[model samples]
Target: MGKSTLFNRLVGKRLALVDDQPGVTRDLREGAARLVDLRFTVIDTAGLEEATDESLQGRMRALTERAVDMADICLFLVDARAGVLPADQVFADILRRRARHVIVGANKVEGAAAEAGVLDAYGLGLGEPLRISAEHGEGMTDLYTALLPIIETLTPVDDEPETDVDAEEDPQGPMKPLQIAVVGRPNAGKSTLINKILGEDRLLTGPEAGITRDAISVTAEWGGREMRIFDTAGMRKKARVQEKLEKLSVSDGLRAVKFAEVVVVLLDAAIPFEQQDLRIADLAEREGRAVVVAVNKWDAEDNKQAKLNELREAFERLLPQLRGAPLVTVSALTGRGLDRLQAAVLKAHEVWNRRVATARLNQWLTGMLEAHPPPAPGGRRIKMRYMTQAKTRPPGFVVMCSHPDKVPESYSRYLVNGLREDFDMPGTPIRLTVRGQGDKNPYKNRKKSTPSRLRKHLGKGRADE
Candidate 1:
């Protein structure tokens, strides 16, 4: 299919591997691509091959499937010289089932070779295929035309038209900026909560649930931080969500979760331990985001102390994933415990964005190993040689060990839990990766060698000698 040539021309770099043989691209490769004025995420998938189970081709099929699922569109390349074959038909069928947007490329289309292949591809039922000699860079204009509509629909505009209504109504000058999204199940007082905090009619407060749709993002300042607060619609059980708009609103709220660094899961003080609330917290934990649990309308509770203790106990027992997350009680109507809520959010955010020094991490690792040595397997003591912080933004660590595979998952969990407790990294996801030590020592060649004559002269070497 000559993907390397086409990829080079599009990405303006030799990013994809080119070979005379077939099926070089076995995994998904993402690169920012530009066609004329349009820019979008381009994914290169393996050349779809037919294979039975328990074969290399089967593994390639699975890999390609995942890439197809992730891509917004698929640019399927077919060899023009060979024309569309049975394998191409099978590949086209697979793409047609999975990818919503499929654009076909008839490669090596020079002189008379392309005419029949281009016509043959239409039989694959993917509309008219774009014929281009990728090596010579011809017929790119046609390819550009095919991509324009896809880009317009999928990619969002850089700037939206400034609404005059917002300009006239919104206040001028500096304000405290905080972008917070209030999310929970129906009747969680998400909108009411925000209205009480802002002390205004910024959001429409009501008793009936699921009133808000399309996350209502409000710009304001809290303490000193400038914030954009978002009020999202109530999320409901999938079976109960009957309306199309409700599903869309739920998706929008989910998207808000990704954009937010700190998510405040509002809980009903009356029914605090709902399954939906637990699921929301789990989502935040899985996404490696900071989370704060707000028990709203707390003033209404009769046995406040008993209720708080019960809730905390339940949280520990049920949500082990968010073991050290903050649980703040607040009355949305009266604004009681508002300060505590703000403080909890800031602290959680700090933990989420925390970074650990490599030296400190190694020191901690050394202490841990000394206290509880790694278990011996088959009479061989497994040595965890060294540790390093491989990545941040949720601080991930890599442990170089004699046997990576032998390091049990239970032990990894122990280290992760310890990290949360010892390092003050609560309510944030921490990754511990175990890597087998390579065959060659990186520092082995760097040691200075003493000459034989010098060693002999010093061989009155020891004071005893």
Candidate 2:
């Protein structure tokens, strides 16, 4: 009924300890909590305590302080039945002094026990308190309204908002073509793979490698899905690359990685998953592009099984960032495995470009919250309110919570991993952002009136004058 139960409700799990026992939670247990159209970092904290800088309790105090420091806002939960206690007053002071913002929640608010507490909670000085029954999900509408501001405030300034709004509004039948970039080290057969897929020497090819000098873009249709394919020059290690043309090609390839929805890393099957191959894969991952690995020239390999096993092991060791990535062996020379490779590429691209409707995301979020509620650390429950997809083309999402900054990296990974699994988005990079509710809207009013019409009217008036 209090922060404890609310934390449990948000995490969708029983991980956050909730019993009649107070102060059972000690350390911070972080998890993803979904609220309406947003996802947030839900931190389970041990209750706030007074401790010196050097004691064990002090360290715990410091940890809680850190969590508060990271949070965009604090969900200051109070037991409505008990009314506002001296402890809540002290913690509210601490939150006001240090936290960027604070939201007061009066938990266990089903009956008369909540009325006095809810009234007294206003004395915490965090503003009006929200009455809620975390156990029964009562007063959620008020909670949502109170949290809207915090969510809007935490959105990254550099993030591109309204990215697909226009497209969503369009009456057009489908979305635009996906942009995919094919990249690899020289002699990795990048050009060969692209040319073969297109059924023509759209890109110049030769027995000699590194023939492609520039990043060439070609539009192609596969499986009824339109795609813009970028065929890039072979990348050589920086020190070994002395030619100006090679340097330009490598730079171009790197740029393509940034813009690509999916990056196909082709490797020579005879020496797959080498250092360079790993480097290319890592680059794609860091750039947040969906990745697909193609082992080219597989038909030429004599010890196929051993080589395949070796490649798999190398992938595990060198490119764990691309876990569950689709790995296909193809002989660009023979067109073997070509269909599988194409299918994998398309699938990966689709995952990268995926967008979940807000309603569905909220439903999934509730399930998550019920499964793994946020823990209590420093005697306070971290509240996660909602989650939503903010962008695609690598499928990024934002979770609105009471404290966005307080979300731990491990918990972020947990959310990202969950998203990949639940959405069948393997091989794609997923980004999870925690935003405190009610972030400010940056939209400003522009002076309006059709400039041409206004000018004409003004001219007519002036002529009459």
- The count of residue-pair clashes in candidate 1 stands at 12
lDDT of 2: 0.78
Local accuracy of candidate 1 as per-residue lDDT tens digits, 91-169: 8888889998999988888979678888888888898889888889898899999998887888667677656886577
TM-score of each: 0.57, 0.54
> Top model by TM-score, which number?
1
The residue ranges of model 2 lying beyond 4 angstroms of the native Cα positions read 1-177, 223-226, 375-380, 438-465
Candidate 1 lDDT score at position 184: 92
lDDT of each: 0.79, 0.78
Query: Which is the leading candidate under lDDT?
Result: 1
Instruction: Name the runs in model 1 displaced over 4 angstroms.
Output: 1-179, 377-380, 441-465
